[model samples]
Target: MSWIRFGRCLVAALLLLGAAGVGSAAVAPLTPDKKVERGGELTASREEFHLVVAKLLKDQGFLDKNNTFKKGTKMHRLFESYLQETLSDPAVMDFLYTSLKENAEHVTDFDAFGKALAGEYAVRGLTRLSESDFQELLRVMNVLADRLPVRDCAGMLRPGSAFDYHWLELLPLDDARVYLRLTKQALVAEITRSPRIAANTKEQTSVAYQALYAEIRRRLAPEKLERFGKIWGKPEAAGDEELCWGYRVLLSGILDLPVEPRRWMLREYANLLRPPQ
Candidate 1:
């Protein structure tokens, strides 16, 4: 059977037992209604995506433990299933197949396949790229960016380690700190306006943000400090553009906040990050 079907079956089984209560012997699954009302279900789940994937790779012994490592198990199976389904998708397979067919004579290595795909997107315009394409693009980015593992860079030494959750290496500590300080305040205001989130949950988020920020501050470097300043202070400066984008994407993923507002915030911050050239 298909991976998607399998995943749904798993969820269905959990939901069934959850509904039956099983004489208090079974733990109930969080209901969809509750998840919608609380907001944490989706936010937390989405935030865990990378962390889960990281753990999966480590647990499966996919990486060289000495050089590249991860700590967590939650992301492993979920991400594996996601990749399986992604590859199984006919459109993605077709894209890969067609690209391979077109470049068969000249291109060979796995890297060449990736570059061809990226080139195809570039020619088509980013607007034309589908969600699958975007997902694939991010996979390529992870390979290219080689972002320091949360364990190594963030000072998370153990499994399930995360800033606001645990302590490890602290490489990005300072960056997380300053950004969270600004973002938590903005989110509180937004939530207050919408009332979609409970006041307690917002407070919890504040605590999470505060803890994360403190952790990040400890890891700041001189160049990163400068970059942070330029991005946060002078949004109009060209130097801040790239920095702002990095901050917006990374922190949004880390914090489980909407990227649209964060992107706007980054744009605004960019103006203050540096003087006009």
Candidate 2:
């Protein structure tokens, strides 16, 4: 699962279901379908790559202009599943940890690494890492490298407290957003569709959600003290007892659950989530 090709596969599988391992989902290279020849090199342009992503989002009705499924849209389970499965799969974690470890050990100069990578292909393509993104990636990897793998998915928070999804193994800064979107959008859709659901619950869910996002922004960054504005476009207001949990039901207070905690995030999110196997 070279970082070189991760996003390419993620987009190609934009519509694929069942499997979502970057390790197995590897694609031809960095970006999308538009092939261009530049100085005898073949690679997709960022413009073309973004175009592909835009179309995929449109066709699938997955994300809104805000880059979230805030319109009550849920893409296929595959996008969210990528994070879910990757975070839960021991094999995937092993591959990721090893890659990040090597990158950290060998690539002291991220800019130099990017420069070297750029020349490897006759041309470069989509999801190709720019020096900035690569630097950010390394920074993220640094944080990840220091933490115990699986991100303590089983212990993200105290038994009585809450956890942030951003700390989850799915690279919360990136794809975990999709997981949140899918999980929430699905919950919203279900509430509307289910006669078994309560209406005030949606209002409560909304309050919790806003509070959750605020807290998510607060806890996830170096500038945790910001009172307003956004971090990565997520609100940094603050949270309350209506704890906003993530990753899955296990951290959703499973042990505290009166029913079998097998999986029951807002009623098991039965349609959207499953306990990590």
RMSD of 1: 22.2
What's the lDDT for all of these models?
0.31, 0.29
lDDT of 1 by residue, 47-134 (tens): 2433443443444343322111144543333333333333333343344444444544554353334433423332223212232332
Candidate 1 worst ten-residue window by lDDT: 20-29
Q: lDDT tens string, model 2, 66-119?
A: 121223334324344433432333332333233333454454443343323322
The parts of candidate 1 lying over 4 Å away from their true place are 1-74, 110-112, 115-277
RMSD of each: 22.2, 20.9
Q: What is the Cα-based TM-score of model 1? A: 0.27
Residue 237 miss distance in model 2 (angstroms): 36
